[model samples]
Target: MSDDLPTISFDEALPITAHVDQLRQALHDHQVLVVAGETGSGKTTQLPKICLLAGREHIGHTQPRRIAARSLAARIAEELGEPLGQTVGFQVRFARKHSEATRVTVMTDGILLAQIAHDRQLRRYDTLIIDEAHERSLNIDFLLGYLKQLLPRRPDLKVIITSATIDTARFAEHFDDAPVVEVSGRGYPVELWYRPVTDGDHLDAICTAITELGTRDGDILVFCSGEREIRDATDAIRAMDLRFTEVLPLYARLSAAEQHRVFTSHTGRRIVLATNVAETSLTVPGIRYVIDPGFARISRYSARTKVQRLPIEPISQASANQRAGRCGRLGPGICVRLYSEEDFTSRPEFTQPEILRTNLASVILQMADAGLGSISDFPFVEPPDTGQVTDGVRLLNELGAIHDGGRRDAVRLTQIGRRLARLPVDPRLGRMLLESDRLGCLRQVLPIVAGIAIPDVRERPAEHEAAADALHRRFWAPLGDDAEASADGSDIAALLRLWDYLRDQRRQLSGNGFRRRCRAEYLNFLRVREWQDLHSQLKQACTELGMHRNDAPADLAAIHTAVLAGLLSHIGLRDP
Candidate 1:
């Protein structure tokens, strides 16, 4: 590490930094401490430093998001006067960074939990920090329970749970009344304005307010429910005559570089239209104002429907506060709520945990494999509904992961169930991959799995969906005299063909030539690159699992056979 650390620009000491002694002493006194701090409190980045200063050399930190983990690792590395991958590193799915000298490790909660399967003691680290505990996902819940069990054995190991103000009580109680330490966040005043949602278009309100805000000093951030809202709002804003602004869309489906555009310190006015992802974990710099549409897609699993129901509903007051705080991170700002104050008051105090709303099939499998015993006995901070638990077990039994353990309702993993849990992909996709070898189609299924696992490469604009679809067909259309591809004429065949085409040209031509081919085909080049990375990881996983590898493509039926075999339970017919 060099003496010249990254330059510090903020003159105002963050709330966390002001209480270093109290935080450090609290960590020393308690085995588990809950740190409740709001956004801009500097707990996420500064806590690692406090851990280091407190002599916990090896710090294991888990974040709820990959982007947040990577970005935060970079920030901390810079602050520590060390290059990334040296002192600070992050590990996420299919991507990782670190060295033997790495002291502080940041990773997604999933990766951290995955570590438990191999390292029961977690001897590599002395302290473990779970950030973003407020948004209680399944991985976080399972990890918390597992860690609670492991702590007694590793008596020297320390644990710290950091969360926003919403769920401090639950976390503290979950750890058997772990001491809670609260830090007040940045105190800049944010002026709140209200406009109730009307029967008219919401994009109009977003556009008009943003255009008006663009005329003033700093950037404007607009929060939407989904990608459709993002696109419509972007188009409406671009259609306006704002000469000094750059309108960008931030969503989960966007490429990492495209998402980085929202964080880039541009010289001109920037308007970021994003989903609830921007509500927490990420801080967009130079945001002087925030516009909230007050609605977001909330997932509700239906046992009867056997699928997730993603309905657009009003955001809770906690989310609204989170959105407004984005503008006040660096300075005083304004928050424009596109809903009435009465409606805001009617919303829930906190958004329900995702573990409750989502299907628990995957979580149950991991828990069963992790020796958590059973879903009903799992120590979740907030237990999911009994219906969700029953549905999860039903699906697992259907997949043959669990069979009757001889008792009335007891279940155990079959041989295939153990293998399914070993695979990193979802159970359905894992089944397809395993069966592909039997059908002589491992090669074909690999690319299709990659496609499902990554973002969609075909970018469809709302205004140009038809044109985009036609352009995509150019690549999907069958090649001449190819019997394997034309066997079923399925869309899966086209996706495989596209992957083959990209790989073929890369072998025959230069990098630029392959990129040109992708552009002419209306493909997202970055997504193609991501797919290649995922494909490589899949191949590695298969090889490690002692599966035979096929170096050549298989016939179309072989691929479709495997895909349809896995999706048999999901197939349903609906009336037109």
Candidate 2:
């Protein structure tokens, strides 16, 4: 918005800037524009600025990640010769620094959906840009459907959907054939090597290949599907101690500080082990080699069991291409794929839309809060499973967030339900936190509830089986009356003694004991922080409700009942 800002160069040797300009013009003329560009194109970074400079109005861009939103905002602001959050700002969960003068705001798609819940029409901005539509996340898909219904009504609003490998024709047909603009990305020669795994090797073969490759000068990026594989691969590489390699793990579970380490430059040759999160939304600097495991962890929802399972599956061809493009960012590079060429030929061209696989409860709650009625009538690029939709409605009804008996023709939230939705937590955890007040065990119950909902707090050392078991024992609550016995007399004392032993062992012997305590367990630090935060919030809520914050613990039955209020759905029985 400021003319005094430094002139940014659009004079890149790439010919895509013309397409960017064309897309910008189309955005100006029509209320919606769909732009398709290949991987490595400057579209994600450059196009928003084009819109900002051309429109002289506020613009909002949504990314699928907090890291991507923040980093991309900083990069674009740097190019404009302005500090981040001055002209370009970003918002993620628990962090925001946007001002009235800010012309462009970038945020995760979830944040945008949260915003829409409060302000249904998103009246704050004149233009909205949805980046990475090809990801087909439930939130992104819902936003697309909502915006399609919104465009004709809000004539002044301009929308742009950007994706690298999206089927433009399909998207165009979805949007009633919105103007489609294709942009060619900067091309680089990349050599692809496909190696099929035999019976002897699993993912460990990747580390062996890296070691055999021997002292590559540039950064190495390895793509796996989940945090477990990333951590396992990183540990294996560290065990090998390949000279001059700075091993770093990248995944969503890491704290913001830890995630930032992967983006910063390193002195020695770097090896970044990451999930599919790094495949599309992020751009890591100085990568020259890519190791593709060809598998990603996908969250699948089961309507019959009403459970969500995270499993590893082969990635789509589009995802593989994006992984390959990581190597070519600087110049010509090599992609070492761990699957056979024939396997690659048989893989699906594009990943399935997340709307089809994930739990639709949250999306349904959001739509109900926004007065979107049942999600079935909402126009989606790919509609979710009918059973999943029914399951979502049933869950909402069970939670009292919606009152649609068996049919989901109409829905409304209760007062208690509205408060639960306001909390930035899963509905179950939110319900648990709220119930802590009525049960009068706000202190102890809130922390455990939050802990369960947050990431795990235990950290296990690699292959330390004994240590992992010890950590689990330290944290695990005893079953039935045994839990009560532990809470009573010498059980607490015995637990304290175990903690002391762990503390002492951690102090000495390089915390191998502590690592051993967590080896088999999936402990995460963020979950611990969330627990702490939940405790603080529950205390605050208690004070607001006229309950004493420092009251003594209530009856254990009440505490368990409060926990059951939220965790009823999570309850399971074991067979004898």
The numbered model that scores best in TM-score is 2
**Clash tally for model 2:** 8
TM-score for each prediction?
Answer: 0.72, 0.74
Per-residue lDDT tens digits for candidate 1, residues 1-576, read 223223322224788877888998998899999999887788888898888777787899998877788778987887777888886888877778999878889999888877876787989889999998888877788888887777889889999999988869888988889999998665678999887658445767887677556577898999987665576578778888688789989876577678777777788788898888778787777888999988876655555544434456678888899999888866788998988999889889888887766667766777767666557766777777777677677777766677754221355778777877777666667778888977778877988876766557777868778877776665555655445454444678878877877788779976557666776666766566657756776787887787876877677778888886656687789789
Candidate 1 stretches greater than 4 Å from native: 1-12, 197-200, 227-232, 252-261, 309-312, 369-371, 385-391, 403-576
What is candidate 2's lDDT per residue for 225-308, written digit by digit as tens?
A: 555556657777888877777888987657777888887867989999887777888878788999987887565654554544
State each model's CA lDDT, in order. 0.77, 0.71
Which window of 10 residues has the lowest lDDT sum in candidate 1? 2-11
